[model samples]
Target: MDVTIQELKQREAEGKNDYVLLDVREDYERAEFNVGGIHIPLGVLTASFDKLANHKDDEIIVYCRSGKRSGMAQHLLQQSGFTNVRNLEGGMLAYQG
Candidate 1:
């Protein structure tokens, strides 16, 4: 599953923090800029699944450098029993625009 940048922005405008936005990028990538997401690098997501366990089955939006990693993460989360996982389409590059 995926969400457009506009949809995400509208959700933000609605003050909807109900969804968890997970950033699978590296720490350095996050330091440069992010969509106010939790800093969980892709390399650590699986091992640190406990940290995100609470968000499972919730509205979780995963993203990465170019959407590839996040897509993988989304798949992993789904396999791990996360019900409402979505990938941010086009990633931050699209969001920045």
Candidate 2:
């Protein structure tokens, strides 16, 4: 599944933090600018799945520079038994901010 930047912003505006927002971008990219998602590089997502064990059933929104990497991250999460995962469509590049 996927979500647009506008939808994400609306979710934030509603003070909804119950879901997990995962940033699959690299450190440098995140340092440049980010939407305050948890910093977890895509390459190490599988290895770091344990960090998100508790969020398996929670809604997870993943984003990267573009949508590609985050889409991959979403797939891995689903394969690993994550019930609700969504890739940020167009990623940060499409963010209005």
Candidate 3:
């Protein structure tokens, strides 16, 4: 599944954080501008699984600069048994738009 920037922003405006936001961009990319979330770059996401194991059953919204990296991360997490993983549609690009 996927989430649009509008929907995400709406949720934030409502102060609804029932999901886990996972930023899959690199350190420098995040250092530029970010919506804030668990910072686990895609390259090390697999090794960082333990950091997210606790939220395995929770809604996890993965995102990156463009949606590509996060889409890959979403797949990896799902393959690892994450029941609900949603890639942010168009990712940060759309969010920033």
**Per-residue lDDT tens digits of candidate 1, residues 6-79?**
99999899998889999999988998889877778888888989999888778999988788999999998999
lDDT of 2 by residue, 38-60 (tens): 78899999999989998999999
TM-score, cand. 2 vs. native: 0.94
Between prediction 1 and prediction 2, the one with superior TM-score is 1
Least well predicted 10-residue stretch by lDDT in candidate 1: 35-44
Clashing pairs in 1: none
Candidate 1 Cα outliers beyond 4 Å, as residue runs: none
- Clash totals, every prediction: 0, 0, 0
Q: Write the per-residue lDDT of candidate 3 for residues 1-97, one digit (tens) a residue.
A: 8999999999999999999999999999999989998999999999999999999999999999999999999999999999999999998889988
> C-alpha displacement of 40 in model 1, angstroms?
1.0
Task: Tell me the spans in candidate 2 whose CA falls farther than 4 Å from its real position.
Answer: none
TM-scores of the candidates in the order shown: 0.95, 0.94, 0.98
**Cα lDDT listed for each candidate:** 0.89, 0.90, 0.95
